[model samples]
Target: MADSESGGRPALARRLAAEAVGSMLLAALVVGSGIAAVQLSPDQVGLELVENAAATAAGLFAIILMVGPVSGAHFNPVVSLVDAAFGGLSWRDAAAYLPAQVAGCVAGAVLANLMFDRSAVSIASHHRASGAHLLAEVVATAGLILLIFALARSDRAERAPAAVGAYIGAAYWFTSSTSFANPAITVGRMFSDSFAGIAPASAPAFIAVQVVGGAVGYGLVRLFYPPTVAPGRLVSDPRRQADAPHPSRERSTLR
Candidate 1:
């Protein structure tokens, strides 16, 4: 089943609350699953990838459905940032969203660590920041931003909740990065030394790519989906009054 809701934006408090809760859930699922997969089958690359993909899909679907109505379900800072760039959201919203996402991610990772036992936290995993892995993260994140913006700008937001989850699952298979798609997720993953751990040094490159991807996606959406509805029309144009004929003149003309 899908986890989504109909129209209307949340107020600042509601949005922040949603972001906090959603990010926590997302982080715990991502890190917790990765930890479990490795412990279950340490050398099975295919199994790891498959489990990771499933975890991402399930966790994301749940978060979106649960918190989407409150915060647009933007658990990722990059997603929120891109939404802001595309004018789907405002700067004020972004200001509240980014920090909440990051903090929630860190908190979630720590919680997962506690759940799995501190000694098993996976923070020591060497696979966290290999160059190839970092590169994969960049490409995967870019694709995600593109997908998010395209779906959002399309006449299809109503259809997006499903498309987004499916697209992300597929992207994990195709993209070299297994579709991490979110810097916050990446950062949170670092707390685990399991199959998903990413080194701190590698984070900058990943964040750079994600931010660039978000901006590019926003630009692409703006290019293709120029709003057909004018803002002035939505709110009556005061200048339209200035151009109106005087009632006295109209009356004289009629006479």
Candidate 2:
């Protein structure tokens, strides 16, 4: 996952571009689907959630499948950071990926806004920072990381697409914060004043908790399932087939 640029690996530019494009599409899926759900379901919050969750989940699966091979389709900064921490990816590569992901998410958010006939950069008005919500973020993020590594170690990387999509979809219901377990997505959500948006004021706490949750997840992963491969080889390894569930293919959905 380093910038080794060897062993049939893609060049660094391709990987970064893939991350950006993948992340951009992911944000669009999230914000766009939420907008559609609001329009389609109106004030029926429950139904709206159902619609939003369904679309995000299904789209996540497709996105991952379409882009996983090129860049592991991380689409989440925490995922990339954790991958690097364990040497599944190089620090250099992971650092570069962070900006690409963030930028892609921002672009995606703008795209969603424009697509929905809204301003290009309206800040979110929804604030979600209750104690319970924060706790949910921790649980949601930790579970996501653990799940990813668990599949990799179990030699079920191929099953990751479905598993990941299913888990995120389920998390949307179980987690109080609706499982915004990804930092890039959290940032993207801030740019939209819609069903899936989070107010900027609450973003800091959410991002902080996500990082903390990531640490907890990696801690647990290290505790129970130590690394089997050497450094620079892991779940996000360019050579490793991208694992993580794709939602709709399973008759499902994550984001």
Candidate 3:
């Protein structure tokens, strides 16, 4: 049977669909874990931290491995936006991806709340907007984007999927903001009063820092490794430019 969306089968569309669905489910897992952890044992600070970190790590790894090929596994909008800014993705794709991520994150939060038998969790209740916390958010989110783009630009994304997970897991423990690198995720997480939630009021501060950090990371990428235009207008290879396609060839072939 022909698919309704395209009036026939479409592999590219199907792949993108799968990526969106997979990313949503991954976000749900993170929210679910946070809600369950808080509901079951809200006061166990040490234990809850461990559980949350483990759960987030597992979900992140799954997302990267599952959708890495489909959509580059960009579950975070900031990462997608930054990549688009760098000319890695089209503005159209970025436009779609940003809203998809936000919706996925919100859905995850809602699902987590339902599972925990609560309408809302009071996460991020305290210690959200202080100087140190803001700084932590900046540094943590910056590191996350830096690691992702750096690996991708270096042609190592396929090899180091696990590093993304590890980086996030470690950031939770090391950074003061607990590594809320994703604005959408943070907003959704705030809906739940779980270990992962940040107060809704504090969302803007964290977001500001995260944006700054992402820009800094992008600037750094441009500085040490400048981009060049290939003869065919294709992106320049980070490792070498000599083998890039010639734009003239592309035009002649099309014509």
**How would you encode candidate 2's per-residue C-alpha lDDT over 1-255 as one tens digit per residue?**
555476646787988898999999999998999999989889999998898888888888888887776787888889898988876678898999999999999999999999999999999999999999999999999999888876766555666777778888889999999999999999999999999999999999999999999999999988988766433222244333233233322111111
lDDT of 1 by residue, 1-255 (tens): 223222223357776878888898888887788778877878998998788778777677766767765667777888777666555567887888888888888788877778888643456344435566566666666666666555544433434456567777787788766667787877777776666667676676777777776666656656765643211111111232334345321110000
Identify the superior model by TM-score, candidate 1 or candidate 2.
Answer: 2
lDDT of each: 0.65, 0.82, 0.65
Cα RMSD to native, each candidate?
10.9, 5.9, 6.7
**Index of the highest-lDDT prediction:** 2
Model 3 stretches astray by more than 4 angstroms: 1-19, 39-42, 120-127, 228-255
Candidate 2, residue 133: how far the Cα is off, in Å = 0.9
Clashes by residue pair, model 3: 121-193, 122-193, 123-193, 124-199, 231-247, 232-246, 232-247
Candidate 2 matches the true fold with a TM-score of: 0.89
In TM-score terms, candidate 3 sits at 0.79
